[model samples]
Target: MADVRKHMIFHGRVQGVGFRYTAKYLARSMNLTGWVKNEYDGTVVMEVQGREAMIFELMKGLNRNQFIQIDWIDTEEKETETESSFEVKY
Candidate 1:
C-alpha cells in the first residue's frame, strides 16, 4: 500500500469531547503514523499517514461517535514525514 498523509481539520462541537482520544484509538487500530491535537479554534487537528484504506477507516471511526458533533472534516494532502507512531499531542 502506498503511504498517504493528510492534514485534517475537524469542525463542530469537538473540544473536551474525547475527540482526540478517539482519534488516537482509531489511528492506532488502523496502524496509522501521525499526530492529533486540539486547536484553539475549537477544531481537532490531525495529521495521519498510512494506507488509504486504513485512513478511510479511521475517518469512519471518527464519524461514528455521537459525542463528537462533526459539522465538517476538512482534509488536505500533505508531505509525509517520518513519524514512528501515532500520538495525541498536547
Candidate 2:
C-alpha cells in the first residue's frame, strides 16, 4: 500500500504521561516519519506518516499504553513529508 500521513490531535489526559516518547518509540519502530508534541491546552498533537496499516498499528500501540488515557482523537489527512525520522518535538 502507498504511504499515508495524518495530523492527529489526541485528547484526554495526554500531557505529562510520556506520551511524546511513547509515540516516538512506536512511530520509529514502525518506520513512520513525523513528529509528536504536547499542547498547552492539554492535548497532544502528532503527524505520522507510513503505510496505512502501520499507521493503524501506531494508533493501536498508543491506545494500549497503560499510562496514556486517550478519550478521543481528532485527525485529518495531510500531504506526506520527506523526513526520515520520527521525533518528539519540544
Candidate 1 lDDT (Cα, 0 to 1) = 0.90
Top TM-score model: 2
Cand. 1 TM to true fold = 0.94
Candidate 2, superposed: residue stretches over 4 Å from native: none
Residues 1-28, model 2: lDDT tens digits: 7899999999998998889999999999
Q: Write the per-residue lDDT of candidate 1 for residues 1-90, one digit (tens) a residue.
A: 689999989999999999999989888877899999999888889999999999989888878999888899899999989878899999
**Candidate 2 accuracy as TM-score:** 0.97
Best by lDDT: 2
